[model samples]
Target chain A: MNTYIEGILILAGINLMAVLGLSLLTGFTGLFSFGHAGFMAIGGYTSAMLTVKFHWPFIPALLVGGLVAALFSAIIGKVTLNLKGDYFCIATLGFGEAIRLILDNVQYFGGARGWPGIPNYTNLWNVLGINLVAVLVLANLIRSRHGRNMIAIREEELASQIVGINVFKHKITSLMISASYAGIAGGLMAHYMTFLQPKMFSLVKSTELTIIVIFGGLGSISGSVLGALVLTALPEVLRSFSQWRLVCYGLAVIIIMISRPEGLLGGYELTPSSMKKLYNRLRLKKQAGKQGLEGGDIQ
Target chain B: MNILELSGLTKKFGGLTAVGNVDFKVKKDSITGLIGPNGAGKTTIFNLITGVYKVSEGKVIFCNKNITNKEPYQIAEIGITRTFQNIRLFKRLSVYENVLIACHKNASYSILDSILMMPKYKREEKQLKLQANELLEIMGLSDRRELIANNLPYGLQRRLEIARALALKPQLLLLDEPAAGMNPDETEQLMLLIDDVRKKFQLTVLIIEHHMDLVMGICEEIMVLNFGCKLAEGTPYDIQNNPKVIEAYLGVEG
Candidate 1:
């Protein structure tokens, strides 16, 4: 693959990992968080600063960045997670902007001039491995009893509460998890790009993540992966037409959503059950071909 | 002697007194029926017991523990679970998942176990599936295991609510208007199910119901409330003939 194309794919995979976490927070927990980009910023800048300022190892710095983002989210979540409905959205929006402004002005984090000379430790293999880990962790979480309860809370908080669910605790925990994932993605991203800027983690980045989650089915996992890929590649695919690309992008999203509002897959999950059926069918076909070849040899 | 006691239970929303210092006691393992007119505080008592709302003033003791100010989930942890007047099942979830989600508190798998899908998690999951299936079978909903709770017909949905609450394995089960939305035939079946379940689970049941015949048929004892205060408390026969109960049920025919 071309280096530029490979670079884009790697970045897209990182963004996909971050958005899958966002999908769990917003799509499953009924939390519409605008602060996701803030987490990404936290992760990217922390990892970048730690590596450049202290000369730490790549992996440890990245992990520390994730933990720092999780810690930040826990503190912010204590205040913002309680705000319901539109209020919650508004609070998260403000929080995201506040984080960006802090990063933009703070001298330690490049003070809007942007951080440079970070090593490009992230590559295709690294991004793929991280995405695999992200998918596995989230898939397990969704299949568990706690994930089921989170859906129940999303569907109806009052009923869940009466059924003995700790509403506040679960919401906060979920927010922290998503935040940590975003942070990790951000840290990986800074090392991959070999440069960082506070403006990279602005509201536009948050909206891009939101678009992927909303365009994906709210409660579906693979839907998020599909959404992220298509949305990321749609513009590139349209690049031959040059200026018409944005128009094509807008029209494509609008048409698809209007035609099938539940997203491409709706809420259908690619669970182990369906995967086993596919594997069985493929095995049967392959076995039949093998038998045919053996019979031909006898002839 | 009472296993659960409520003393001076009064709930006032501004000028309206919903429950007016009404005292009641629930004997151990007894099915007590609370009946009254539309606005009576029967449901309010269930809410108070479950801690949906803080009491304006009252003392609620369950099994020698003061649970007057306990949080809702705390109330459930202490072995009390209740259904709503309106059917409140997790509608979007499958019937089996609904019951499994309720049994989450009792689940033995740790968060790490779930995240890792270790041997212990898989074993517990199998056990959870079995337990959910048994509960669904008891409620005559096993065949509809994969059906979403909301898609079930109204009567079945109400039963699903009961099934979900029963999954908690509560020592005390409170039912608020369980038969409200059921047809006459369904009501009879529900009455039977309620009695059999109470016995099978060894649960102490406190039911607030409006259907007089069904309540009279199944309830071992009766408590009558009117305008948020106890109008009468006795056996079914005693409650039926009491003038105060009659006045509460029907205007005095002087």
Candidate 2:
């Protein structure tokens, strides 16, 4: 029972990192990245090979893996972010597949047979510590001036530029940050699983990260955290109806979209004083109108 | 000396010449109006000056430097800011956030310093919040500072757009069709607000507006464009009486 609990923690912590990374890119910056799993592969393979071959320490190996992913992201973002909207998304999807194919066919690092003996060094404490750092750094980044500029760009690029935000530069910086976080997530994941294969970092995994961001509203940091937690737990809770579990999940998604499309948060944010303000506003609306609820502007 | 000088500025969309070799100057510390009916290339001229569209010919001199081909951000960095005709507020961000984002550029904090939360970033961020609140107060939107920008009333949205532009501390401010779709009372209030803002900021203001009363009530000088050419340029009284300007507005397509 303890081992099972540990396994779930490991999965949740690692997935929290990856999905938060996706949230920064697709959710906050509105970049629509589909290459996170590719960066994850870079992190996973690089850290795994370094540890197995060179016998490097865990922390340094993790950093190197993140750097490698960042390098790839910078190159890809430089070319593809200029394409605008869905073009960048599709280009990233291609990039993810290309990375996977290259990894699968490679001569070294065990190729398709996968890399083993990765040494499961990521325990609950390590997982929690790393996830803590990820959340802290992401929260700070979102609150910084760059984060505000990113929100501006995401809302309206032209207005951002007219106010002197170099949109392209900000986009690349954001992509790099997101890529590095994904890389770290992958490294932690590789250690937790004690092995890795090229197939593990697939387009489906990338879609999963994007779905987390979508489940949470874009531009809402708390939404990302909540979305990751719910998604990680919901499947386990539905295991009794094993055959219908995925169907139930799919139905929940549809129902949420059909009923309230802006997402669970509807782009509404939770800052310190906002809780009080929200209560006050809800009370005011209830008193003013005969209706008990209102779907105010989501964006 | 003029604050912004455009010489021989032309724009071409395929074979059609949208704006043809227009020579224009906007002076400092005064409200200038750019007025024309639809299809007169009034908005196109704004687009050219602000670097939204590249000029096919000639130079744009801002504060005595040739900025003909600079990107919009670069132009804005030199202290020229503009608002869109459609009111391009950052819709997803809070009204306060929209203003603070513009304020970030001028705050004296390095990127590394901000990420590390140096005392400077905290101090600046707080100051920026205060400044944003004051600006919102000036625009009568202090109560709605936390509201998502797109949710603001139409008149309040326009004021917020101006507030965001003002956050940049611009020397030259261009407002495109700022009085669009406003009732007479709202337009009158907007006219006073524009004057108040210009006086308070010591700003060189240029507005593209369709409201004749708004233009005549406030603008010291007005430029009328017709078919991509300058039809009239004078004080408000002269513009109201100019034959070509009147004909351009009233007798177009005849």
Candidate 3:
């Protein structure tokens, strides 16, 4: 593959990891967040520190990075998960910006100016490999009883509690898992670029991740995959438009939201059974047409 | 033995008292009915018992366990579950999936086991599916199992809510207006279904209903409340003949 193409693919894969985590929290659990970039920053910085300062291997450094992000989310979730709806979203936005400003003041990690000299260990093969594992684990989790409990909470909080589900605990669990995913994505991006900067994980970055999740279709993993691929490549594809690219992008997103608010997949998963159902409906329509012709249009 | 007891049970919403210093007991293996005029705090009492509302001043003792001030989910785990006045099924999920979600309480697999699809998870999942299917069949919802919950007719929605509540395997089942939206025929069917389920599951039921025939026909005992106070409590026949009950329903001459 061409180097440019490989780079875009690597970026898409990293974004998919973060989107997958956000999808679980937002799509399945019905919680919206604007602070996930904070998690990614923590993950990226933590892993970069391990690999640079301690000479840790790529995999272990990534794990520790994810752990730190999860820990951060746990603390934040404990305080803010109790807030309902938009309140929680605002709380997360505050948390994300707070992390960025704190990092700006810290001198050890090369404050405001940014950290350099990180290793570039991210590659196409490993990116694809990690994504495959992440997808597999998420698929299994969604199909399990625990996942069902999360969906139940999403659907109806009071009903879920009446049925014996611990809503707060499950929300915390979701936040931790999602934060770790964002963390891992940050870790990969850090190594891929061999640099670190708090600016890379700004509120805009967090908004972009959330936008990708919504654009893909909430509650559908396949939708997230397709969304990550298409949206990430869109700006590059529109390079010729230059200044008008962002305007076009904004217009396109507004149009999609208006036309298909549920998103590209709309919670309907792309599975063999669903495909078969569509095929069978078409066959039934054809059969009805045949019957009509044979009967010669009965009055 | 009493399955549940409430002493000095009270609930105040700001300056308004919805329920006040009331006491009641539900016996084991019995169908008890709570009937009152609208805004009489029947549903409020159910909420208090199930931990949806905190007690303003009272104690809820269940199976000799002091259950006051517990969270709703904890109360459920301790074997108490309820249905709402409004049908609150998971709207997007299919009927089978709805019951299956409730049956989640019965699963023994850990989160790691579930994610890994370990042998225990698979085994338990298969069993849970079978149990869910059987429950649906008993509810006469087997044919509609694939339909999304919100699309089901209002009557079926109520049945599904009951099924979801039962999936918790509670020793006490509180139904808040289970017969509210049902037609006469459906209400009759519901009475029979509730009785059959109680017998089969060996459950103690506490139901709030405006439908007097269904309540009087099935309740072994009855309690009436008015203005958050217990107007009367007795067997169905005594409650029927009580002058206070009659006066409460039809105001005395001025």
lDDT by residue for model 3 over A175-198, one digit each (tens)? Answer: 999999999999999999998899
Q: lDDT (CA) for every model shown? A: 0.87, 0.86, 0.92
Instruction: For model 3, state the Cα shift of residue A112 in Å.
Output: 1.3
TM-scores of chain A across candidates:
0.89, 0.90, 0.96
With a 3 Å backbone cut-off (N, CA, C), the pairs that clash in candidate 1 are: none
Model 3 - which docking category?
A: high
- The segments of candidate 2 whose C-alpha lies over 4 angstroms from its true place after superposition are A266-299, B252-254
Please give, for every candidate in the order listed, the TM-score of chain B alone compared with the true chain B: 0.96, 0.95, 0.97
Root-mean-square deviation (CA) per prediction: 5.6, 4.1, 1.4
Tell me which of candidates 1 and 3 scores higher on lDDT. Answer: 3
> What's the fnat for candidate 1, on a 0 to 1 scale?
0.63
lDDT of 1 by residue, A169-197 (tens): 88887888888889988998899888888
Provide the interface RMSD of candidate 3 in angstroms, 1 decimal place: 0.8
Cα lDDT of model 2 by residue, A1-299, tens digit: 48876777678778888888888887778889788999999998888878888999888898899899999999998888889899999999999999999998897977888878898877888878887887778778788888877877888989899999999988998999899889988999999889899999999899888887888777777777777777777777788999999899878777876786767775666767878999999998877664433544334
Report the lDDT tens digits of candidate 3 across residue range B30-132.
9999998889999999899888899999899999989998999999999999999988999999999999988888887988998888999999999999989
Off by over 4 Å in 3: A293-299
For residues B1-254, could you state the per-residue lDDT of candidate 1 as single tens digits?
56689999999999999999988999889999999998888888888988888899989999988999788888888889999998888888898888888887777676679889989889888888889899999899999999998899998888898888888899899999999967899999998889899989999999988888889998888999989999999999999899989887779898
lDDT score, residue A284, model 1? 99
Candidate 2, TM-score of its B chain: 0.95
